[model samples]
Target: MSSRERVLAAVAGIAAVAAAVAAPGAAATGRHQDWDETAYRGQIEVVRSDDGPSDPTVLNGTVFVDRDRDSRHDRNERGVAGVEVSNGREVVTTDRRGRYRLPVYDNMTVFVTQPAGYQVPVDEFNVAQFHYNHLPAGSPELRYGGISPTGPIPDAVNFPLVESSLTDDRRLSCIIAGDLQTYNLTEVEYARKGAIADLARRNDYQGCGSLFVGDVVGDDLSLYDEVKGLSAQTNGPARFLPGNHDLDFDATTAVHSFDTFRAQLAPAYFSYDVGEAHIIALNTVRYPCTPDLDNVDGLRPGCNDPVNRPRYNGHIDETQMEWLRRDLAKVDRDKLIVIAGHIGLLNWADEGSAIHQVDQVREVYELLHGRKAVALAGHSHSIENMRTGDAMQGWRDLFGIDSLPFPHITVGAIAGDWFSGRVTEDGYPTAIQRDGGRPGVLTLDLADSSFQERFTVTGENDRVQTQLGLNTPTYREWYVARSAWNSNPVGAAPELGDPLVVDQADLAGGTWLTTNFFIGGTGSTVTVRLNNHRPRQAVRTQPMRGEDQFVGPEWSDPAAVAEQLVHGGSVANRTMHLWRFELPTDLAPGTHQAHVTATDVHGRRFADTLTFQVVAQR
Candidate 1:
């Protein structure tokens, strides 16, 4: 018998909707009964109304065939039939041609659960190609996220079949890339030259996949196809989400703000499993500008009326929130939960900035409780690993500052600063910020319930870049004041480069600049020696922002500042203008640090340092 007839004959005795509920731990919805019900009268139709043949020879419908047996299309797959088909709310089967259709709406997903015995095609990299796009004419110019607006859907949503398997434990791995907001092709090239090259060389990822959190291209949706081509550089499947710059300017409503994104990228809010973690990528940019949108305290309408709306801000709306709840429900409690988005939660690096806030971060955080969770995000073009234990533990700590609760890492941009300025040896901007983070991508290895984070610098060195000394309260006031006048005071750092000659007078009473370096390596020992030391003094405060005022454990001088001022608190404006250190020779074969001070071109002084290190074994 023919494939269609064979399939029908095989299930002809079966009911139209199988009564078998999916087994626990299976998570996947099983067979639909409609496959054998040839007597049923509901028709499967394809309606394409453009200036084409009245009787177009082909009916194009996007199909997502079940490949991994996970009941969801992971990547690279288009749906097909010989498989059971359903709209979730309705049931149907593919025609004798292995194609089927039920009523499709602007936002509906026409899916096919992978049949028990067929394989879905995969690319050269082994990534699954399992989902097809079904966009009929008269559908809104932009109806769903990632739909290509440049052309209409083709004649037929075809599925290239391979072999099939029933085993679901494929050791899935999804590559998570931070921001790549390339405003132009040049920036895209920068990304290609940098970590994109690195990704191309990697194939060990579980699921052998990659998902870019957001800012795929700097405010330009037109560059997506080129970005996709760059993604082909990788050895696995790739997916993407919408960032602030990916907004749909032509969208008539806020609901459609991510339309172009959906057409070109993956769903704005979707989930897939890799290893033991359920990774969900979200679109935090709620567009369709709203008037009362100046980083307000409680705003919910930002995602509803993006057009004619006031200012655009960052947030997760009710629709997405409800979806998140449903998505999380499907995940097992024992699995690690990883939530990746373009905007970070509680990012102090861009403190006081509204555009980078996740209006509903706390709500999402609550949903993933009791499960091992890590929130990975980007938008600031910087990398920070923040943790809170006490207050951040929620009501237990009253949301006050305590120990880090969980790690919240903000990944540096793949297209650092929109591929800022001149290109370096790597064909991209040396885009190393004075704050110490070099432009790069972050690699997270998750196994079971644990993960390790690695920041891969763009160029050859894989330098472990980090910020050294931030302004103490005294210096903070100075930097703040000078920064108001000089847009780049941080660049004009004071040059206290020379080693200090500790003398009796210097020891009597003096305050020194402290350096806080991040991304240090193993076996690294930070050592210090004064050219002279009548008083052996070194107080290295913990390396942190907004709180680097004290010296190391070696120093215990409370009056250093007061004595130096010759007047108590009156010297509030007095900043720490002098200090220095050298990179320890014993640092492990990785990144290291050396905090120092310096005087600017003018008489004014500023405190800053360096974040450098020895290379580690690849």
Candidate 2:
């Protein structure tokens, strides 16, 4: 209760303020941890501001409504009439000055969708030009993966714009292909002949352009030139991302994984817009092997420059993350965002390997929230049609069926199995599966935000080729009887080049079987039935194996197309010993039937029937 006590209190306050300033995540003037994590509508931010009334909320800057990137708002380049802008969630729009304002958060992205008939500036390789965030201490680096801390929203969020007519056309389309992992020149030729042939012919996709997800080539980087040559055959622009195999093996640092990739294939991580969609291509691989024993190739002491030689794994570094945050901020929530890369966000196989998994996968999901999106990838040479919301915990299980907030598809290989061994009649390898199924490609038809997908094999063209059949009880007995007759081994090697066929059904478990029905006529439908009924009841119903496995679109013979278009007659179905349908349950010892009917895209029908005997139930 005296002058001495008051003086001591003032001095104590000063000491407390100095201590707070010395600590991390703290500001001056002893404002404590009072941070505003709310939404804001500015593009510039200030960190380490002194607390008290002196703490300025907005940074000193100007948000000019430059309808052009020339730093001048021209008459014709006037601001769009009424487009909604946002700070991730809360929305606002520009006034006559073509500007907006809202609350600010620690880290934020403020962007605008260019109104139709107008445009925005693009960077050197044509990436859309925009501005955000001036982080002081540089962006934060990730351990396994992720971007830097956002810090705080900037002061002025200004968007630039331009004008163009192609903004609102109906017939726009984009081609998405994956894993052109060509190991040799021959395999590269196979890719060029098979996949490139289809692209050269499709004029409908000229404007939409094409994106090759990853593995531009096998580990051999020399094949890149050949791959790009093939890509140039298409009538659209080609964009690429590097897969694990596309790394520059000679480099000795963390950034070299994509230096050559970026030199040839645009920005390793970037974004572009086309027809109501925002496409984000991310560079998930972090390169440069370190002294840490956990590195894949392990300590490359011979190569030691971080900039020249990069080492990496499944990851997104600080630089790319900062760009992504700014990029996503510029995009409107309602618009569709297509995240395309070589590695999938969710996969079933090799789930634990850091080499294949994205460490910050969960954090990226949190950033996007529940906006309309789809993720596409190709590293594993398999096709997976996975819906969102599925648990992707392990690698052995197929995560294809689980529902998700967005659909994710892992497209089949361009050179199925490195064009494996010998070339087939189609000028490509017969690349039979180690797992199962022939080669194929995926086709996605997008309408605005909604889209449909179909898998088309290089030689076969049809929406559905799966044939599910039931096993008769007698057939079950035969399946079991065959096992006993196996004096040697159950899986004795069959003749080379013979189609992998199962004649004797294994009653222990029912397995899905498949038949490749390459029908090439109009008015035709391919249907499978038991006996005379279109829907014959089998003792056991099994799905067709490799039914939807397709690697490329149908490479049709123009002569065949012309002939079939007019004549419209049924061709005898070639049974290549592709699949064997199993009869379910125990059928009374007697004769049973198997049949198939084909109805082409033109609506004509063709049918075939075969019969087999049932001994007894297994």
Candidate 1 regions off by >4 Å? 1-104, 109-174, 289-310, 351-355, 388-405, 433-435, 460-618
lDDT of 1 by residue, 1-618 (tens): 543343233232221112232111111223221211211111122234467433333334444444443433345555454444433234455655555545544453343333323434333223344444444432356423445432343334443343322212333334667787878766666776677766654444423256787888766777766676566555444667678778776666566677676655555665555546666777787666564543344434444444455445667877678767766775679877778888875553444444566766668777876778888888876556554331222222222334334667676677654554456564767654322355677766665656765566665332333223322233333334443434444555332221222222222233243332233222112333322222222333323333423332122111122221221111112112112242233335543334433222222222333443233221
**Clash totals for all candidate models:** 66, 70
lDDT against true structure, model 1: 0.48
Over the stretch 1-618, how does candidate 2's per-residue lDDT look in tens digits? 443343344334433433333211101222112211210112222224334223235432223344324544445545554554444334455566565665554534344444544444443222233434323232233221122343444444456554443334433456677788888867766775566655544444433456777888877765655665565454444667778777766554454445455444545665666666777777776666343522434323422444465545566766566667766876779777888778877543334355565645666777788788888777766555555543333422332322245666666667655566457686877553222234555555456665555555545443433332333322333333433444345564222111122233433344222233332211223445866656532211112121322211111111121222222221111121123344443433556666765443435444555454544332
Candidate-wise lDDT, in order: 0.48, 0.48
TM-score of 1: 0.60
TM for candidate 2 is 0.56
Deviation of model 2 at 394, angstroms: 1.6
